[model samples]
Target: MAMAKLVVTAVLVEGRSKSEVARDYGVSRRWVITMVQRFLAEGEAGLRPRSRRPRSNSRRTAAAVEDEIVELRKRLTEQGLDAGAATIGWHLGQRHGQAPATATIWRVLTRRGFVVPQPHKRPRSSYLRFVAEQPNERWQADITHWALADGTDAEILNIVDDHSRLLVGSVARSTFRAADVVACFHQAAARHGFPAGLLTDNGAVFTGSYRGGGWVALERELVGLGIRLTHSRPYHPQTCGKVERFHQTLKKRLARQPRAATLDELQTQLDTFRAHYNTARPHRALGRGTPQQAFDTRPKAAPTAAPVTVPAHYRVRRDRLDTTGCVTLRHNSRLHHIGLGRRHAGTRVLVLVHDLHIRVLSEDGELLRELTLNPSRDYQPQPKP
Candidate 1:
């Protein structure tokens, strides 16, 4: 527009030739003549630039559909549910015959100020993530703290399937002990079947390795059922990132509700949230399908063997032969003494055991004794003592 006005002024005011003005401004003589003609006809108004946008956009989403998207966002936000583009699209598809693409929904949201741009946030593509291939392949368990009406803190233990992100269990307790963790896991297992593996942090209730290299009740329960128990590195919460993230989402919803005065009230809220999360709310990671839907879409994985009532692995110990020529070991929470003859009394030995097959080795690496342990007997009589 500035160039056009300059050329027209040079031509009309200075009485310059069209060719001269065109040459001075590096514009075509035909363009100079046209601008001059438009200037003469319409004055300064004709010098303003016209829009280059198309007269019509047939591929654009309908205004009614955009209104529906905005309405869905407003409703979901009011309900304390996810209002993301994928979720909006999921709801839109349900209400309308066809739904716009997620990108389109995002654009509408941005234009309407329903979405904020997060330029500094990390992109999902840059993340290295792992998910189980089948439902029940792995379960992630974590505990989060919440406050009650009386200002007392309560704990909510949550269990989520790694593959489907299903909320298998959400229990509200004043405090969670090792026994409570085992009971919660059992309740979830009874409903969804046992998972192939269980993942958790090195919390005292979840594991006892940090205490004295012994198995906690929860760990013992999983191991006895042929389910692999795994713990994230100490202080590294990202190893159990999925459950940690779920805690954030769950708390966001719970924060909007009235504070519960009792454990039962909190448990009721948890049950309501769990039901909606599993069957109604759309999950962004699951391609907008509910967790229950995703879980039901795949075949569930099971433990390698049927869950048993007894332990599967025995602990290995190092001890010196007693003065009475016997080595005692704890098996299945019971102590059993093995006879090693009076000659080897006071000698150090290594007890290597797997199930009932026990091997005793001398400190010098000699195989001192090998026998099948008889758990029924407290003392194994020495042969030919």
Candidate 2:
């Protein structure tokens, strides 16, 4: 094109032969003449052909519609919603009655000065076995945050039965500390009786103790009840797969109701959800049967929960293991030292078992440590004893 312009200038200025200009610039004689005429009519500006764009946009979304789409995309993106402009367009067609293809929509959006957002994909963790052979066998408990009417965030600690996928009990509280959750757990246990086992992530509330266990007081309490406590592997959410999946359903259903004004109000709604979920909603795991169906079929009959009384058979020795993990036990008029799980212990427990395993229990009948009695019991040498 530049060569054509030069040839055209030559044809008009020095009247240099078109054949000579064309040969020098490698252009046709006819091309040189056309360029010369264009230059004469429109001057140097006419040397280049005009763009095909019209003065006005031919295929533009209405200003109002474009503004609406941009605002919607921005809102969704900021809220961590999925998709960019193309997805926004599809979402519009499916949800809001707009059917523009993703590409056409992109042009409209970009022309309107709306930028496409960099999309995010949440990496999926591995799967877990929340499945159970029967209902009431296992339950998982966890807490999630929601806002109150006053815009204050509150914690909702929930319990869901594993086999039937029933929402057994859930409570709303201000804090997620272990004490608060233990309070909720006790509340649930009192109503439903203790489950076989409870599974939870290693959240501070589930694992640590209110007094000093570093493990939750509830866990120790459960262990005392003979209820096993299973902690999900750290950084491994898949271990709590069922509980986490239930959370998704919960957010959708619970978000429908207005935010509660107080913990009581939240509990009321959660109670309603619990009932609805267990009794009314059909669970796929239950072959599209209601969770209540599965729970009721077995007819557990709610046996009287006998207190786990410490049998008088448990020998209580007063002279206990000091901080050095050396405990003095009197058996047949002899003081013997026993090794606790750790070398250093304060008042360590020692259970006398005939077999190799020595079961140790704390004062509260909780299993403190288990040590196997060696065929060879070491008698520490004392100076000139």
Candidate 3:
């Protein structure tokens, strides 16, 4: 617009020739003539910029198809199902025998104001993703908190298959205990078969290593079943990314439904969601195939009877608690201060380092304090009961 105004002014007001104005502005002579004609006929309004969009697109998605996409998005959202472009495209294909490409569906959603731009989100390519090669190769487990209609807090334990993105189990309770985790694992394994390995965070219910390197009930059960067990590094949830990501999806669906009044009600909702997620909803990571399809099509991996060995970085070092009742231990070139309480100051202790897991014992070999070191921070404070 500014260039057009400048060209018109130079020709009409400055008494410049059309050829001279076009030559000076580096625009074509025909463009200069068209701008002068527009300024003369419609005044300044004619000098405003016009859209470069084509007058008509013969290959554009049909209005009816676009309407169906919008309708599907709305219906799926209302039903608490995934309404992403890939899932929507799968639905369209299933219903009409043909569907627009995933990119086309995304463009239509954006044009209809259904998609929000998130430029600050990290790109998926930058992530170092690890996936299981086949179904039952590994399973990731995690617990997330939710609220009931009465404002009471509830914990939902989610177990997901690493290869197929299947929600093998989703159980809700007022609070989850080590026993509950073991029971849930058994139930999920009974249905989907045992996985070769289980991945989880350093939650106490999942592992007793945080206490004194003893296996918890779930860990013992996994060992008895010959399934390997692994815990994510402290303060690092990415190792169990699959199940952590599933928690977000589950919570989204739960948020769309009416808040449950009881644990049983919440469990019912979870059961329904797990069925739909495993059998109906298309998984974006699996080329839009449902989890059940992916799981069934692949060969299952069996549990290995390999013995658990100490981590490569495992070491025991002697140290005395400083006046602040904190003992510092360095692992991976980073120092971490473990709090053992003020009374234990000046006491001799052994700092055991197993990767990021830590345990402090008195000189007599009595366990004094144990925790997972949060490498992001220097001080590891005693967790609140």
Candidate 4:
């Protein structure tokens, strides 16, 4: 518009020739002449910029197909399912045997006001992701909390195969204990076969080392089954990002359904979601294939067939000395209390355990006591100093 107005002003007000104005403005003479003529005839409206869109587009998406796209977006969004352009296109192709390209679907959505522009988000290309090379190579596990209609809080344990993003297990419980974590692991293992390794955050149910130098039930069970276990660093949840993300997806689906009145009802909802997610839903990360397809596409990884010789358990736990100046450790599911001198009571200490051998260190790094625990006794008595 500014250029058009400038050319018109140069030719009309300055009395410059159209050819000279075109040459000075670096515009084609034909354009300059047309602008001057329009300005003379229409006064000012002709100088305004006009859209260059063609009168009609033969390749435009058909009205009926566009309506179907909008309907799919509404239906999927209402059901709390993914309704992105790729997903909608996949469904269209499946239903009609031919679908518009993803870009065309996006344009249709934008034209229909179904797309909201977000120019501030970080681009997906900026992320660096790590995935397991084979199915069952690593399983990521996490627990999320939800509430029932009665306002009772429940915990859901979710496990996903790192390679396929398959929801190997999802169960709801009133509260999770170390025993519950072990049970869910075995249930999923029985169905999908044992994963070569498991990755999880440093939750007490997953690991006992953080609370004290002890072995939790889940940790012991995995070790006995020849499966390796890995824990994320303290306060770092991204180490188990797969299962963490799965929680968000599951909650979105749950949010769309009627809030469950009981745990059984919630379990039913989870089962339905798992079926659709594994078999029907298209995963953008998996090239529009479902998780079940990806899980079955390649040979699965498993724990080595040879029996694994379990190494001794070793961990360091930070604690405050109790009034009795004692700390506790659990080995082979048995709890043992070790005695430090009464004088050290109320001091901060670190308890380092290597199998049955124990070393208690003060906060200043001074070794307060050291001893080998006796399996036959619950209390490890201190020696005369």
Q: Clash number for every model?
A: 0, 4, 0, 0
Per-residue lDDT tens digits for candidate 3, residues 1-385, read 9999999999999999999999988999999999999999999999898899999999999999999999999998987778999889999999989899999999999999999999999898998998999999999999999999999999999999999998899999899999999999989989989888889998989876577545566765665566777779899888888898888888889989999999999999999998989998888889988899999998999887543333335565555689999988776788777887899999866566777778776644467987887889988898887
lDDT of 2 by residue, 1-385 (tens): 5765667767777788878988888878787877888888988877887687888986666777677678767775554333356556656766677566668668776777775455574544433344766665778888788888999888888787777676777778788776677677777777766777788887777864222233345654664476666667788877777878777777766666776898899888878777877876555557546777887676342212232333334432222457766654444455556655344466533253433445555543455555654444454322241
The top-ranked prediction according to TM-score is 4
Alpha-carbon RMSD, candidate 4: 8.5
Model 1 over residues 326-373: C-alpha lDDT tens digits? Answer: 988778998899998899999866576788988886634467888898
How do the predictions measure up, each by TM-score?
Answer: 0.75, 0.49, 0.72, 0.76
Q: Of the candidates numbered 2 and 4, which has the greater TM-score value?
A: 4
Candidate 3 worst ten-residue window by lDDT: 305-314
Model 1 residue 147 lDDT? Answer: 93
lDDT of 3 at 122: 86
| Residue 213 displacement (Å), model 3 | 2.3
Q: Kindly report which residue stretches of model 1 are placed more than 4 angstroms away from their true locations once superposed.
A: 13-34, 41-50, 54-60, 305-385
Q: Can you tell me which runs of candidate 2 are displaced by over 4 Å?
A: 1-130, 209-213, 299-385
